[model samples]
Target: MGNSSSSLKVCTDHQGGINWLSLSPDGQWLLTGSEDGTARLWSTADSQCRGHFQGHESYITFCHLENEAAFTCSADHTIRKWDVMTGQCLAVYRGHTSIVNRILVSKDYLFSGSYDRTARCWSVDKEKPIQEFRGHRNCVLTLALYSSQDLLQDSEEEESEEEKLSKDFLVTGSTDCTVKVWWVSSGRCHQTLLGHTGAILCLILDAPNRELFSGSTDYTIRTWNIVTGEQLRVFKEHQGSIICLELVNRRLYSGSTDRTVKCWLADTGERVRTFKTHKHSVSALKYHAGILFTGSGDACARAFNTKTGILQRVFRGHKLVINCIQIHNELLYTASHDGTLRIWDIRPLCKRGKRRLKKERSLQGRSSQKGSLSRLFNNKVGCVVHQEDGREQETVELM
Candidate 1:
């Protein structure tokens, strides 16, 4: 297959490298956090800068949008909730003594994981934190949340509010090389999963199987039974630290500093295949609309066919490491350490083969003669009879 080239129609405004991004539920807007210590809202329809929230003193580490408000955590040691429509800081949660690296929002609680070796639970209705989970010896690196419906979906009876609140759990990965599952209602450590030789970097839940998958700096990914706190399997093929993990349609896709993304059979933890394209660490990944997209330190984001393990598209433009990616409404939003947020339209590739061919042919018609070295691929080859010097020169032929 010939390589397909495409360009984006919009590049949102940001001054510093984007650290994180979140898309609105309706796909009409996007929120991005940057090293510039500010977060901005952009209109996806026209790529206009709609609003800017600027009060943080340091890098904006993460951002999440919930309902009509948006929350952002920062190296400034605070998480601020902003009204999406008005660009006003509604409330500031300032309990973390160190940088808040991540945030998780539930129905009523907002959880913040920090470098202070603690995870604090906040009432979304109030500014003060309700409970503090402190157990890991090192800083918490990531947070994941799951419910009874996620772990015990086969139960026929509807769960009571008491049972639902009791069973709701918060999963945290820490630099202490352990995974802790905490009951949200009690703030008690339900289970402490240990076995990693290095720091835990990321984690995800296998909802249907009641399993938890964690990746660590130790270069191995472990699968655990959340209920029993038992180690189910360990995938040790990655040569470097695992950076990101994504689950789609029962398949586990992991990105690693080893410069590859691997798929696993979530149920059995069996390796399905590995796809390599990035020349540097695969720092971020998102699986959406049947395509698995990955971003890396190599300054590229790629879309791969998850089933066939084929690289279908490559997104380029960043000058530094790509920190994150989000896909919404067939649009791929990428955050780069190069200090920009790029919006790529994947619709060109989503069309049928005939339509793709038509576009390719049109691009070919306009792109021919723009470059000097690709005559072989750009035009048909032909022979010309020698006249004066008995030497045939290059001639174009119609296909």
Candidate 2:
């Protein structure tokens, strides 16, 4: 691979790999959680560590950043709230019996999904949970919130009954192969979406379109009408489980265990383009200003053209798989299993490059993934087969 290291800066304060990343509302700072059992704050401008909060006994898994405070979940079966200005542990919220996988913060409520097969909603200032949503037969893997405030903020359309049905609704995706929608205020189950054959890994909402898009281990992406609670369409293109979803400019993008990124028409669910370039399973993705950012278990992050799905520039720093990615305004942030966060000045790479790069997709099919996080992390050695000659080759250890 060509050297593009000079265009980016890496933060190396975390002793273990980073699991989650979030940006402040003002886009001035970044909050990241790591396997080191700590969450650190980084100044976006300088790409330097400003502060760290340590308390969790196990790996930190998820993070949600708001204006004054940041919330992080952990494998320690607890969630800690930290002051954004001081990096101090303000309060700790505990209820889940298993690892907390994801968190969502709305106006006055904090929601968490866990391996305990339930989702809980907690008050921001209180230590105890206000409500617990229980029904899934397996672990909850992801969480998302859709509020009436979101629909009113951007679109010029007038308010409708569907928009006023509930002030806020919480969506939880689980390993039970189902998604549950609940009203936050009353804790009433609004709808139960069931179709996926495998676990739901990631989800994203389209407020303008009033739709919910879910990616799953079933190798399918499904779109549903939020108001009607009906499955509108399904996009089936990825040969492996989808782990990440990005929506931009009325287009939906997905990163899959198949080591590729696929783009689709948000309205029609038609596949637009598939960028097959990663060397291992893709773990994260972000689309901003016509550029696509992807992170993979191959221990590399790459930038791709949204229109043509062509490779642009490669970012090499992480020694392991990248876990999450975020873009605040002009800056690009990536968290990795290498215990580092990287900020890349993408302005230079956004321009035309000297060589027109073609995507590198191997003919060897990806192995089926099972269990939560197994596709992104494995301690045991793996094997790779050469497609051209039927020869078994030992896979290089990336973690």
Instruction: Provide TM-scores for the models.
Output: 0.83, 0.82
lDDT of 2 by residue, 267-287 (tens): 788786898869999998877
Mind giving the per-residue lDDT tens digits that candidate 1 earns over 1-399? 224445475454678889988887777788899999999998878767888999899999999976488899999999999999999998899889999999988877899999999999998878878889989898998999988656755655564566555757889999999999987777878789989999999998877678899999999999998767889999888899999999876678889989999998776777888989789999998876556788999998888766577888888777899898887767778888777787788875555333544554565554444333344434455533234112111111110
Error of 2 at 285 (Å): 1.0
Model 1 misplaced regions, further than 4 Å? 1-6, 10-12, 152-165, 352-399
Give the C-alpha miss distance for residue 155 in model 1, angstroms: 10
Give the alpha-carbon lDDT of every model: 0.82, 0.80
- Candidate with best lDDT: 1
- Residue 78 miss distance in model 1 (angstroms): 0.7
Clashes of each: 1, 0
**TM-score, cand. 2:** 0.82
RMSD of each candidate relative to the true structure = 14.0, 15.0
Cα lDDT over the full model 2: 0.80
